[model samples]
Target: MDIKKGYIFPKPFWSSLIDVNIRGLQEECYEIRNNVPSKYKSNLGQNSYHSPNLLNLQNPPEILKLMKQITNCIQTIHQQSRRENVRLVDFWININGKGGSNVPHTHPGAKYSGVFYIKVPKEMKRGNLFFLRDYNETYLTSQENMGFFKQGYNLLPYDLPKIPVKPLEKLLIVFPSWSPHSVELNDTDEERISLSFNYILFR
Candidate 1:
């Protein structure tokens, strides 16, 4: 008998190395955090500063340019018809200090969501981002507990409960808005700064 592999339903996440001024972006973000009053937050945790919707405020030039780059890339990737278009509906800043962590959550109402790492400390732990699988899917086929844990067996994504992602400067990650994700506590002394946004498809 012969057996092969078939990739069933796959959830994809796109990441790109964005070209922007990280230092300048950091200064701008800090200034905004100092002066601007936060109206909303991204992650619910302590020792973190979350900004409100930047779409409603005077965003820095670097942020605006970065947004243009992101939207342009999305347009190219999605390749929607002339009748359809995509727009950034909301955006914010996240600066996670030591001991900062967020509860698991998902973006609702919008279509796509993403985050850009502006700053990340060296030799960090508990600062990683984790994309998790749905809880209801924890049936008998659950990857968390499989008796077949033997030698010579390759571990695929289907056999993992969560995927870990290390944050790097200038890295941008885009994914479906409904994907549930969370951040671990920032155990390092340095801070972790990132910009998050959501996009919606419109006609």
Candidate 2:
């Protein structure tokens, strides 16, 4: 007799490429950060410098290309047809200085959201992206098997909860807007620059 036990859920997926023009992107990011008015600056969290309008920057072809690739990957995974329309509603850059970190939160009114790591220090001391699993059967099941089984992609450990994302250069991660995520404290002296955006689906 044969039987199968399974698991299913929408988890954040990411892709990376080492060839993207990082220096160019960084230059543009710096310019935007410097030129934007103080009214547009946000210090609500630990962000040292947040660009007012990332996608609105003039002649921002690199960012646009990255956004297109991200959306294409998202649509492809869901098997959405080429004709289905999806558009990015907003995007911004976050420059996290030392001691900067974000509290756990979810995007309230968007179908999909994501982040792209533009610049990360060579030797990162603390800054990292951590994702939390929402309370569900998986959480309960993982708890039950805490000490017995090891956590692998195939066999998950029940006790293991938050997953940390490696913020490598030119890495992009996409996920459902409702997923809860947070940033670890940036203990390093260098700044951590990244772009965050939200998307919506249209008929």
- How do the residues 97-168 of candidate 1 rate in per-residue lDDT, one tens digit apiece? 888777778899987888899989886866878898877754555745555666888887778778888889
- Candidate 1, residue 155: Cα displacement in angstroms equals 1.6
**What is candidate 2's lDDT per residue for 1-203, written digit by digit as tens?**
89997766546455656356888888877877788752233333444776665566564777777777777766764455345556787888888888777777888898778788999988796778878766674466564654455455464443357778878888888777888888887777888889888887787
Candidate 1 RMSD to the correct structure: 2.2
- Model 1 misplaced stretches (Cα beyond 4 Å): 39-44, 80-83, 138-140, 143-148
Worst 10 residues of 1 by lDDT: 137-146
Question: lDDT for model 1, on a 0 to 1 scale?
Answer: 0.83
In model 1, state the lDDT of residue 27.
Answer: 94
Clashing pairs in 1: none
Q: What is the lDDT of residue 198 in candidate 2?
A: 84
